[model samples]
Target: MSKPPSPILDLSHTGLLIAAHGSPSTKGGRTSSRKHAETIRNLGLFADVRAGFLTEKPFIKDVLDGIHLPEVYVVPNLAYRGFVSTTKLPQALNLTGEVTERITPNGHQRVHLCDPVGTDPSTAKTFAVRILSTMDSLKVPDTDTAIVVIGHGSGRGRESFEHTNRIARDLSRFGIIPPVFTTFLEEPPFIKNWRDLTRAKNVIFAPYLISDGFHGSEEVPRDIGFNTKSEIFIERLSHVQPNEMNQDGQRLIYLPPLGDAPEMAELIINRVRASLT
Candidate 1:
């Protein structure tokens, strides 16, 4: 089979805006976004790199208005093209759909909206890397580890689950981790019943979602009995000092969500660049 074309593009003179669905209580949101912005800025690929969010400061319109560049590319820091990416984000940015022309003080700025980070094909590698890196960080062996990819599935929509399935399929084919299984919070194949899904003595449960917010940080842990409550986002992984925790005779590691991780910057950049083509 032929390889796919490179997603990187000549993004010179174009500003990059990473669009994220920020949380009011997520202290890491700004920090993570700033780190990604700095990382992309350090690359010197574009005129500038900034984060514009739907629920936080330096919001989409504000960030868009602040930029003096002639063009800007907005990449959704999302896991899928659900209502957020497809409707809310674009609507917030004043986009008719994909490309929206914004009237800045200097002149009309051309804004190109890229698909969410989760929609990219490269995320599968990111997922694999996240799982492996978590294992390495915790000094856990790769022996009989059931790598569980968790998505913030919707009970009402198929789009989120569909993209998740594709990504999971791609990740499985990569063979980075044997027996890569996928589950969701809202949908079937629930995270609570992961043990029944696979017989691997060890497990690494990873959230396929973008943020370290409520879903990944609180809800997931609560659902999986890793936490007592889902009311607050824990500073790090829930109620564990040793990287790997023993849950019902199974060694499990709960990996952080993709949004807060630094590795996500590469995937964001790729999605932004891919939008140019």
Candidate 2:
């Protein structure tokens, strides 16, 4: 089938810059961001598409300097609209607000700062799609499965925890799957208590994280009794790992972070488009 035309028009000179929170210890986060940027680039909707990181090479400032486009939309690839999206990103890009007009060495450029892609309610739809798809592949009925979304909630503020809980609430409302739960690494009802929190025989762990890195590959698994601290960290080969493990009389299926979802490229585009109007 032919691909649908893009919603926005006349973007021959427009550009997209995905500002991501890079992982210094692992390349997974940077790789995920670049893949999303490439996916959007393939759509032929913009003159340029690039991913820049905060903790890695080709940093945000460098990427911004390299872009010569007259208009660029900066979208935070983070899973939450907390400190990084609201303060760190804008400060790094020298943006004062949603729209910032600045004169760069390359030329005069107009920067449009957009909300983090995770802030989009449709992101919950993406989560639902991923969860249901994984369940179908595993032959695990939704009725018997429990979705536990794990996030790194902060003690400093409620934004991180609230964002994760919101996704859980949204998934619950979808009614496609029963018994969705939320847990955090830094806050109450922590991930270590996942098994005790649900009664389902099959538990699917959806990391509400932008980048899987050490959290998804190691910490979460260890916390949930799937792996030991000494176990080798497995890099994600796909969105859903084919090997499901049996843990304490229950089936455990862990998925890659939300940013790695195939729908993310389109989601980023939508967020950028929304900023235009």
TM-score of 1: 0.85
- Model 1 residue runs over 4 Å out of place are 1-10, 28-31, 136-143, 228-242
Residue 23 in model 1: lDDT: 73
Tens-place lDDT digits, model 2, residues 235-274: 3334335235786788887777777776777778888878
For model 2, give the RMSD to the true fold.
Answer: 2.4
Q: Give per-residue lDDT, candidate 2, residue 56.
A: 81
Candidate with the greatest lDDT versus the true structure = 2
Tell me how many residue pairs clash in candidate 1. 1
lDDT per residue, candidate 1, 1-277, as tens digits? 0222343566768899988887776674344566677787887778878887788787887887788998888888888888888889888888886788767779988888888887777787777766666677776676777778888788768988898888777875555656778899888888888877987778877778787567776677666667624223343443222134677788877777766566678778778767766
